[model samples]
Target: MENRNPDRATESCLVLMLKSPGRSKQRLAASIGPLAAIAAEHLCYCAFEDMAAWPGPVCFAPADEHDGGWLAARISPADAVVPQRGRNLGERINHVNRTLRMRGFERQIFIGIDCPELDERYLEQAADALGDHDVVLGPALDGGVVLMGVRHEWPDLGELAWSSTRLMADLEQFCNALGWRMARLAPLADVDTFEDLDALKRVVGEDARPARRALGAWLANDGHRPETQP
Candidate 1:
């Protein structure tokens, strides 16, 4: 049974899944260098800035238990912190959703900080979609989903394909099997490789919040890669 917070029973919340910078952006790290962690942190900062004025509730799911304090310092004091649990991506997402649903946030949107283009308008669209659809998905150009929101508890997601090109299709079939009405937002890009980072630099250059603009400038200056000791 899901626990319900009476005060927030009718509210919608954004659940951001994050990891400690030291442990994030593994693929980017493999492609770039030690600077992947710094890049990841900057992306998260951009996300934070984007959500700073969101009208709805917001919470964070940290991959590690010890990151609560670290996350706390970056978010508003009213935001909640939930520790992620599960062996795999699918399971972990399920765990976070279930936990939040139990806590009285009936409508919830989940996103990762990897999508630098994600902003307040995109989130508002998802929240609005939930009013008419059971689920809303923001597709990634790489055949994955960058954002997912649900108005009700999801069916068994343990077996769904994750982190693969087949993920979007698998999720659609899963939702179809359960007769859930799913909506899709416009596709976006995620920063997972050196090439993606380069693309993000161009994106933030045109129009971005303060944090993202700073990130764009850093990328322009090749700040992501530091000089190695001889």
Candidate 2:
């Protein structure tokens, strides 16, 4: 069912999911009005496209009611389709990670659907990093985390500050407690706030095609409209 390279799939597994658009990205939606949900949906779609293109096995769990959308039907059922659970970001992520592990994947990476700058090459790097390091983290410019990968099992990160600037630091403390060696990738921006959108525009110069296109459209829409307090 999974048309993945057997050798490659044995080494790494990718976990991805999309939450219902109307229920997610509230801050961005508040900043850009209804377009926020549209942008969030677009970002996740592009992420799925990008990650699905990778050579290894992919675990895709799209929880949205697609309303008879084509992409949902196109997804491979070989990858697990578990909807997100738990009360917060950390719990949901932990739930997903543990589920993937039960499938016997040696390395697991959890990527955010809304992080436009994320692509397949970075995922390759993370999977390769786990061969040596126990943990891998891709930090966000806004002080949140964008990607987290692991090769070794650990406790659920339910206690970490889910959306605060202190989240990565708290994770570092957790790693310290476990005595796990961690690896780092360069920090990237996630378009969670208006300021974050601005920073992403500044940092994502020439390489990220999907991200650039998404930002261009969102920026144009944002510029032509007046801001209201959400």
Candidate 3:
């Protein structure tokens, strides 16, 4: 299939994503204890820095009002900062998609600030895939998707099971139900568990270094997992 050519009138025709970190990744926290918050914050900071330089219009949204304003101060005025709406992750994503589509953004891609390997090249590939397919998905090792791109408004995303092992599989079914042509990218490894972080550290890239440092500190301080209480 031939890829669609980008419009010459505009400088670039991509909708980048940058969602803020606000008490996310419970499994990681469960493994690492209270320091999980610190890890999340650091991971988000690194991702935001990298995504800010992507080759398109970047749209950032925070999970809450406090984080939104905090992130707004850091991003360039050229980039757009959007507030997250809805009570659930699926709802927020669907709302963002609908809003973007209504605002004349036909082709859009949304990624989170969780994955270290979800860099510019991966996103560029997703954007390029959009030229041929109606939807593109990047699967995560944890059975969740790390990236998703669509050429139109898909209001049915709220039905998707988020943050669960069934997530990626459910998304494929959702796309098939809508008859949207789906393209896929390589599996993305995200930091949901210590195992995920360990996997990332095996390669020792700049993205994985901060996480490793944070984990090392936590381990040095708290050698064992905190005992779960009734």
TM-scores of the models, in the order given? 0.90, 0.81, 0.80
Give the per-residue lDDT digits (tens) of candidate 1, residues 1-230.
12223333235788888887778899999976778988988988887875675678888888886666678777777778788888877788889888988888889988888897887677778877787789988888998889998999877677877778878888888888889988889989988888888788778886648888888888888787555312
Off by over 4 Å in 3: 1-22, 206-230
Using TM-score as the measure, what is the rank order of every candidate, best first? 1, 2, 3
lDDT scores in order: 0.81, 0.69, 0.67
Query: How close to the true structure is residue 98 of candidate 3, measured as C-alpha lDDT?
Result: 75
> Candidate 3: minimum summed lDDT over ten consecutive residues — where?
7-16
Which run of 10 residues does model 1 get worst, by summed lDDT? 1-10
**Better by lDDT, candidate 2 or 1:** 1
**Model 1, stretches more than 4 Å misplaced?**
1-10, 225-230
lDDT measured at residue 13 in model 3 versus the true structure, 0 to 100: 35
* RMSD in order of candidates: 5.2, 5.2, 4.8
* CA displacement after TM-score superposition, residue 192 of candidate 2 (Å): 0.8
lDDT for model 3, please.
0.67
Q: How does candidate 3 fare on TM-score?
A: 0.80
lDDT of 3 by residue, 1-230 (tens): 22344331122234434444446767887786665666677567656654665666667767777777777787777766667788778888777777776767777777776676766567777777877788888998879888888887776667678888899899998889889889988997877886775555443334444544554444445332454322
Can you rank all candidates by lDDT, best first?
1, 2, 3
